[model samples]
Target: MTSVPTVPFHDGQSIPQLGYGVWRVEDDVAADVVAQAIRAGYHHIDTAAIYGNEEGVGRAVAAAGVPREELFITTKVWNSAHGYDEALAALEESLGKLGTDYVDLWLIHWAKPTQGRYVDTWKALIEAQRQGKVRSIGVSNFPAEQLEEIIEATGVVPVIHQVETHPYWQQRELREVEERHGILHESWSPLGQGGELLEDPEITAIAEAHGATPAQVVIAWHLAKGFVVIPKSVTSERIVSNLAAADVELTEDEVARIDALDREDGRIGPDPATIEF
Candidate 1:
């Protein structure tokens, strides 16, 4: 089995630096694909209530033959459940679907600033942690200001902040803010959705030099930058290969070359600041 490094959280817990993300994975096939990922040596599994596959992920966890304590499971509360009571109910529902009494990490899926309820939802996550229903609490797609707002409101900083990040969109400024608060930056679309990013000449050259695939090179870059990354793929071979990225090493220059690929308009996902949902 490959040894994956872990990033420590401010709350004394830790998360695997690399994880399996089941975002677009269908519920029916989630169990099979997640099981394959587990067999490929992935101990971190990222899912969300919006993904609608927590049941399948739970099914795989129950049968993986690996003890539950050894796996890092994460789930998020969706935009619809944005109030304190609603978020609490959402966690209960997710816990039921995941078939676990406590989730390793729970997140508010989006800030939905327009709705003006994320602060209340964040309170719910804080409560969940206090109740021992969640080990760590965090947010996804939350901008730096909102991050500060939540902390000021509750005086509890999120242990992790997940966002769309890749070589094309390095998120340097946001990462700086997170770093100041001791929050880990986790990448969602770490491969830039796997098309243009994997075929970029710079990444391809790095891969060729290392005798690795473009995806591995990119994953290696994420690791080298100390960002927790989750690259999703349903293919069994790709799942295993992605995990092998843990072994791909990159030099400082190569990592800098990839870092220089960041663009002012490289964002491919919804901008959290303006997103309605």
Candidate 2:
């Protein structure tokens, strides 16, 4: 099995750089699929309340044969749960469903700037951490300003920021902001969510050169750029192959070639700045 590298968090903990994400996976099959991922050498699993698969993920974890301490589990509070109390309650509910006493990491699914309560939610996460219910806490889909707001309000920087990132939407500016604050950048759509990214001429050419699949090349690109990436798949072969991306080595120039694929209109997800939900 290929060894996945770990990224250090500002909180003194570390996370596997590569993880298995359950985004659109239905609850019915998530357990089996996640089990396959674990059997293929994935130590980190990312789930969220809105994904409706935490229970299945929990079941898989219980049956994985891998000890709880060896696997890194992450879940998030949804947008509906935006206030301080609601966020804490949300974490507790997630814990109950995950069948774990504490999650390795918990996050606010979105800033939901319209509600204007992420700061309070961040405080709630701080309280949860202090209570020993969570080992690390962070946010997803947060912009530079909101990241600053939460940190300013609580004096605790997020250890990681999960967002939509790929070769096309590289998030250069926001990544710079996160880098300045010692926050790790995590890519939610590292393979572009099964879109044209895998079919791009540049990606295919690079994949051929490395004798790898397009998805592997893309995952390798994310790893080379130092962004924590979670690529989701229900197929067992793809799950194993994606993890094999750890073996695909890319030169600095190749990484730059992928970087040049970034464009002004490359964003496929909602803009975090104006997203209400």
Candidate 3:
């Protein structure tokens, strides 16, 4: 298996450009799937406390005999655990479940702006970093204004901002904001949640040009654009195929063609600043 390149984060550390996302995988199945990914040369695994499968991930990590430092493990604190103390306790719980001493990266799962606790949550995340519970801290689903609030309140810039990004909803404006603050942009739904992106003529054309699949074209676009992408799949064939996407190369014209597929009205997830807890 060929290793993928790593992207440096705001914390002076780096993560694999491609990662495996365990969003909704059941705990019973997560371990084997993770092991499969590891065997396929995936060095990064993205999970969340809410995913309820940290133990499975832990088991796989332990059973694989892979050194902890070689694998980058990331998990997020839930919206309910937003305060300083709650965040600390939640990190401990996550650590316990994952059977690890620390996480490579930790993040606020959502802004939960309506709950009016994200600012405090950001503070808690900073405190967690100071306490050595998490090496790097970031936010998920944060808009520009909310990101500004956290930057102003804590004087710590997020390492990455994970959002529902895909070719359809590119979030160019938000990506600009993230660049201004030196935060890495990560896409949560790079495939548009099984939408028509994989069947688009432009993408298919580019894939055909490179002897790749439409999914590979989309993943290559994300990597080329400097966004960390976590594309999820449980099937072994798809998993292996997705890992192969790193080798796909798209030219400037092909990238521009995929960029043209973005639609102004193609949002798939709720806006963070407006979602209810």
Listing every candidate in turn, what is its Cα RMSD in Å to the true structure after a full C-alpha superposition?
0.7, 0.8, 0.9
For 1-277, candidate 1 gives per-residue lDDT tens digits of 6678999999999999999999989987999999999988999999999999999999999989999999999999999999999999999999999999999999999998888998999999999999999999999999888989999999999999999999899899999999999999999999996399999999999999999999999999999999999999999989989999999999999999999999999999999989975
Ranking by TM-score, best first? 1, 2, 3
Candidates sorted by lDDT, descending order? 1, 2, 3
lDDT of each: 0.95, 0.94, 0.90
Candidate 2: C-alpha RMSD to true structure equals: 0.8
Model 3 lDDT per residue over 1-277, tens place: 6558899997898888899999999997999999999988899999999999999999999998899999999999998898878988999999999999999999999988777788888888888788887889999998788899889987899999999988898999998999988999999989986558888888888889899989989999999999899999999988889889999888988888888888999888887979875
lDDT, candidate 1, residue 143?
85
Residue 236 in model 1: shift from native, Å? 0.6
Q: Which stretches of candidate 3 lie over 4 Å from their true place?
A: none
For residue 157, model 3's alpha carbon misses the true position, in angstroms, by 0.3
Candidate 2 residue pairs in clash (backbone atoms < 3 Å): none
Better of 1 and 2 by lDDT: 1
Candidate 3 has a TM-score of: 0.98
